[model samples]
Target: MTKIANVRCQLVDLEPETARSDASQSFVKQETVLVTVETVDGMSGTGYSYTIGTGGTAVVAMLRDHLVDGLLGADARNVEQIWQRMVTGTRATTVGAITSLAMAAIDVALWDLRGQRADEPVWRLAGGAHDRLPLYDTEGGWIHLTCEELVRNALAAKAAGVRGVKVKVGKPSLTEDAERLAAVRDAVGPAFEIMVDANQCFTGAEAARRAHSYESLGIAWFEEPLPADDLAGHVRLAAATTVPIAVGESLYSSLRFAEYVAAGAAGIVQVDAARVGGITPWLKVAHTAESFNVPVAPHFLMELHASLACAVPNGMYVEHIPQLGAISRGGHVIEEGWIRPPESPGIGIDWDLDAIDNLRVA
Candidate 1:
């Protein structure tokens, strides 16, 4: 048997290329909790999860203090069994963010090992629904950028063959949001897609007003207009608007996704693998969204989400945020306007071990 031999976890902080923000909060940095699992025979794989700017040490603590011990000597191939064990063992925190993020690191490492053992890339190992996915730029759309900056970024992305760009909304006034969207729409023109995200900073009534105003500009969707937990409010907003209501980045479990889908509260499902626990539940959420005919445009962690977007049929677009550059070599290859997953065995990221060591804090 390929038995598990050891598990190791560490924390690394990476600065963003530029200041990032949305309606709800500012982007300070990314605190990443990385995990590596090695089998008795010496084969190994690595996986990771992240916090926007905090909680990485806690995730590492959860692994080192509460989770990693159970993984020792466990069957490396029994991914589902081991995932359940971790979930049940942390029953009190099972469906919460820190626990989910902690489990995600370990769970993803197991999937990586599974892929390496089978000599397949994770996208194919998971589902192989498609080989490539359309790319959309979100890095240029921070709420703090001026209208001219937004136009410049969108134009640059278009010139580079990117299919679309997401613009952050939720300024003090709906008029300000309208002006920003209009400037980008007028610049990018009608053919290039434009998505607007409020970052969950509006009430149901305010979101409806903005949705009506943005409809004229031809936005692809209105993302996170209301808070993630407001199921009833989202349902009301969905019914009131012609534009699709995109949600799920804040959600921590597949069950939460099911609740939203069954209630007709979500028009687009934005599952983040790290937030949902791991690739195991990430796939579950995607498939669940598919069952309801809801499409997926996962939130961030572009390096990881690229493979995941290709793994499922319902995956609509992969948001381009590019947060892995500081600790990794190479990147997603964008051909024409679409991004392709790495064909390498296992999860496929080329980690720069020296850089990781340099940044390691825990």
Candidate 2:
């Protein structure tokens, strides 16, 4: 057994092509806390935790303070035991927030180690349940792009062989939001699947009003129409709108999702592998969501979700955005509308050392 030798982490602040926005702060430079685990046998594994350009230092500190001590010198093969030691072992403080983020890094690293040791791809290790995961173009989300630009972008996705697309629609004015959504729907035609995300940028009444107008457009789903923490609001919106209510990215646990399911708040689940404490808990949430008859449509990290979407029956579309130039190495190739999972062992993607250098921000 290879004993765990060392653990180290870094914060990578990567700039986007332009300022990206919704009803909240708008900017590039997404902050990511990257974790690296090394073993006595010279094998090492890597993982990352995502944040909105802040909380990176805190995430790294949590791993250094709480995780490194318990993780080092342990058997790298005993992944579950180590994870439990770091998570449930600190029940009073470990159930949410920074701790979950820290666990995300450690969990992903272990899976990476397992894949390398077994000499198989992580997707295969996780059991390659399908050949490919479907893709959805998700960048036209109200980042100040015009309706024509939005339509052009949607058409480009179709031209690229993508079948579905999502756009943002919380402009404060319901009329303006409606027109933008309608324009895109008209451009994409009736058969193509178009999803709308409010990014928690509306009131329950506003959500219902906007959703009512959007229903005429044949949208595939309505995502985060209200703040994620507002269960009552979500329940109200879900009840009021004929459009399917979808959410889950802001939620930090499968436990949190349980409330959403019980309240009948969401019909679709958007589990983030990084956000839900990495692949382990994310799968747990997927299973739980399935039991509730809710479909899993993961948020961000398309490369990571490729295998995930393929592996679960209720798994829906994977959000496709090119944030990988920030830390990810080669993993998936988008051919037509399908995103292929990496065939390499453990997570299938590596950090491009050279690209990492260019992305450094003090």
Candidate of highest lDDT: 1
* Predicted structure with the largest TM-score when compared to the true one: 1
Model 1 clashing residue pairs (backbone): none
Q: Which stretches of candidate 1 lie over 4 Å from their true place?
A: none
Q: Which regions in candidate 2 have their CA more than 4 angstroms from the true location? A: 89-92
Q: Listing every candidate in turn, what is its Cα RMSD in Å to the true structure after a full C-alpha superposition?
A: 0.9, 1.8
The sequence of per-residue lDDT tens digits that candidate 1 reaches over residues 1-362 is 58999898989999987899998899998999999999999999899999998888888888989999999999999999999899889999878999999999998999999999999999999999999999999999999999999999999999989999999999999889899999999999999999999998998889999999988888899999998889999999999888998999999999999999999988899999999999999999999999999999998989999999899999899998988899999646888779999899888899999999999999
| lDDT (C-alpha, whole model) for all candidates | 0.92, 0.81
Tens digits of per-residue lDDT for model 2 on 1-362? 48999987877787774557776567556777777789999998887777776677788878877678888899988887887787766577656777778788888888888889999877777756666777898776554888888899999988888978888877868888788888888888999889988888888887888899988889889998888899999988888878899998888877888889888998899988888888788878888888988888898877678877777777778888767665666778789988887778888777887777676552
**If scored against the real structure, what TM-score would every candidate get?**
0.99, 0.94
Weakest 10 consecutive residues, lDDT, candidate 2?
17-26
